[model samples]
Target: MDLQVLDFPGGKVAFTSKMQFISETSEKRVPCYRVLDDYGQQIEYDCSAQVNEELAVKMYTDMVTLQIMDAIFYEAQRQGRISFYLTSMGEEAINIASAAALTNDDIVLPQYREQGVLLWRGFTVQEFANQCFGNKVDYGKGRQMPIHYGSNKHNYFTVSSPIGTQLPQAVGAAYSLKMDKKSACVAAYFGDGGTSEGDFHAGLNFAAVMEAPVIFFCRNNGWAISTHTREQFRSDGIVVRGQAYGIRSIRVDGNDALAVYSAVREAREMAIKDQRPILIEALTYRVGHHSTSDDSTKYRSMDEIEYWKMSRNPVNRFRKWVERNMWWDDKREVELRNDIRNQVLRAIQTAEKCEKPPLSDLFRDVYDTLPSNLHEQESQLRETIKSYPKDYPLDVPV
Candidate 1:
């Protein structure tokens, strides 16, 4: 194959062109775009509710419910009722509003913390408890970890534990949707930390080149498990990377529900109509510990967390907006908090009482037909259980 030299208006490139060159234009900082201010109030421009009153109320209600659910579940993990857990503490708006902006048919590839997306799509509190508890009713049949949730009916993919694997998977799924001539698009959610992974680059490049209808939603919550965004990347956050890959992108106030909703709504439309990828970098903070395994205070200050909690809480900001609109009241707020608390407690109790997945489930779902090796292993396990029935009560065949 012959290598051809290409000439352009400002520059010429050839196989022998030196890779090292300084471009002052590329070094400029890109401004973060936002539609709403810290108070959930529209800033320079107005973006009215894209949804009607009923849907608007529902979105607000879900955000409050999600906050309550996170409180209870985090407590459950501390009490050792569940093995582990992750909460969408400060990113509720980014989760719920973004979900509200998409149709039910759109696919969601979530990182572990975006449980609000699943909940907004009608995943019941009981179902969440079931999965976290790894009970018989869990859709994963107790196979996945506590926060790894998925629903085919809801068009949400099962979350993988690997950090950046979902980015490529979302691109592939969007490509399939394009090939099928479907109107839907795929949304993949990841944190700022995921940008450090190789898959993020490959996925974005492929999506842009192939014109896959997908949204790469990066929740830049300023921390990737205690490593702050400053140390994560030297670029102007994740948004500039999208421009580098020739993908349209935006940055939004992640704490402002209205801003996030508006940004995602437009992104979805452009993605479906233009058959291209869009990147969203949601600027927010993580108010809670990264997970049950982490102690956030070890690295971050209580004063910093308190500042975000008091000044930029997404739930409180959205609540204030709803209150100003006369769509919510103090009495309703009290009622909602109490109602969600009771529901969460009830679901936790029910899930804890449910039986664990049967021992046979371990061998099932691996393949269409159980391999001879697995069958032999299953038989050996059963015999061992039979020999120590009391010690293996949960493994006893029903």
Candidate 2:
């Protein structure tokens, strides 16, 4: 059934101001949900038998790959090989588990941190390396900086740096799916800080009013840049915000892969079959610096990071779960690491040596018929590059 049209209790003018004040006041303390104990035991969320051995192993593999990739990229940044990097260190469960629960046809709109989802859904290691290195073979032709990756092949919408922009775009995509009568959904991922943006409100309102087939996936990773959740808003966390929009919502222990996967599975089914919008707020933490440029240690303690690392490590917990079911070996852990490490090394080598894209690339894709102004801009850019020394090559194709 569709949600009843939302109305202002005190009518438009009075309710508008009240709503703003209430939203502001409630921002300081948000309730968080957890289906898994700190020990990684599943608390009460339902996991269907369909979440069988094969799926568990695959999820584990994806999580491992994500962790390895993050670590490798961090090293690359540290070694001055790459300009920047972001770590999904503590939230591997949010990335892999959610992707694992989705169908191939579903669209994913990710915030920058959710690369693991794309990798899980068949994004290649080489492709990832290409984007990271801004190599000639990069899909974006070195225009986008490292980690700003996208792929139409896997139905992942290109990520936008402007926070909360994807929320409305996801709503639009979901509406389109509804119009096409497609049995698929769109999942929009964002951080808790993004919840405070106007785009987030607009997107949720549009989805609720139109009954768009979208899942609003918020990774409440405890901090948005240097701003803690307490500072971001006073509300009962991101999940409760969904209730005002009439969207069915839940909060899950984001470090727990099973809990995250199970919530996503149920949300996806509902969105696909019923053209409903769901909001899932994942309670997790950011275990590393915000990016290569930021020092989280200045804002948080070593003990806090260590606490999450040792007690709530998503990768380790999933490994334990797999062991619990006797589906995998702890020794395969070594083999898995070697295989992935080698793969990443090779991909980095290939990406590093590859040239950047051609100068013509800047002008090619914006429009079918380039405007005279853009044509002139392209020419100016080419000439500027040509003026530089041969060793400082700029016009060279990636």
Candidate 3:
């Protein structure tokens, strides 16, 4: 899985032979690996070995579920049910395919938009709703905002608000696993926008030097909020950065679910066997806005979004594959989608009806034993709430 290439213009450093400077973009760039064409037909190579009917159906269904979940939740935010929301639209393959490749033991450090990974690991739709609604049932205990989900049982780290913070954390976790002789590796996921952060470079360098088994998975969907990736950097993309850090790297077609699955599966093997870091830059698009807070039309054209949705959607592409293989039909599609929608609506209703976490949770979860300062603050808070009872909702247990 490791790609060997020259570091400089020449094979080795020469005193006077053909001096050259790095170009903004190179003609000879890293190639993107694709297993299927736009029609979901195999592109020369047979992908059945990498993705069979059973696995393909699961991946497709999971991706569809993710699509339905994101849409319904995004709408819920707009309708004032949730505070905020973000989506992995046009990047579903990057989520579920890569997730399917890894074992349950692999620790996940995710950026905000990798919900499909959580779904594949058995984090139920109700769990998603619980976290988004910030209900008492959420494992995070309503401490964080919507979608900042975590689960110790799933071995997935809770997502944070800060960009690129997970990169370093993933590296440290991988190093710990290495030193402890654990069989598992770490999958650190971030977006192209995160590459600009200093943490990205530091994490890659640390993992490379320490020979930690970690995979740096970048969903390069061409935008970080409002800034396009081209403006974010001038290099050929994220793959070349791995070369600079002495890490094995590959660029995969993020829309092609088979390619993503195979690339990540093999990458994991190489990372664990060699005890070295690997980088995968999954090229895709962001058809939806950055989040419920953003209107993508301000920066990108509606035509462009429509083109990707119609011509290059990962979900549609996978559905085509299943249809061609005789494993799917219109009836199944209709039933599956309608059921997912109903389940998501039910989840939202249940989550909304659940009580919010107790007011004491704000101070109780952070420490083993409550400090005197926190105790005093809690006391003051209780006293204030008691005096001004009407101002604070009584339903929120004091």
lDDT of 3: 0.92
Residue 264 alpha-carbon offset, candidate 2, angstroms? 0.5
Across residues 159-229, which tens digit of lDDT does each residue of candidate 3 receive? 99999999988989999999988888999999999999999999999999989999999999998989998
Give stretches of model 1 more than 4 Å off. 1-28, 44-49, 393-398
Best by lDDT: 3
By TM-score, rank the candidates, best first: 3, 1, 2
Better of 1 and 2 by TM-score: 1
User: What is the Å distance of residue 295 in model 3 from its true position?
Assistant: 0.5
What do the candidate models score in CA lDDT, each in turn? 0.89, 0.86, 0.92
Q: Write the per-residue lDDT of candidate 1 for residues 222-278, one digit (tens) a residue.
A: 989989988998888888888889999998889988888988998999999999999
What is candidate 2's local distance difference test score? 0.86
The C-alpha TM-scores of every prediction are 0.93, 0.90, 0.95
The runs of at least 3 residues in candidate 2 whose Cα sits more than 4 Å from the true structure, single-residue gaps closed, are 1-36, 40-45, 380-387
Candidate 3 regions exceeding 4 Å error are: 1-18, 22-24, 46-49
In terms of lDDT, the poorest run of 10 residues in model 3 is: 1-10
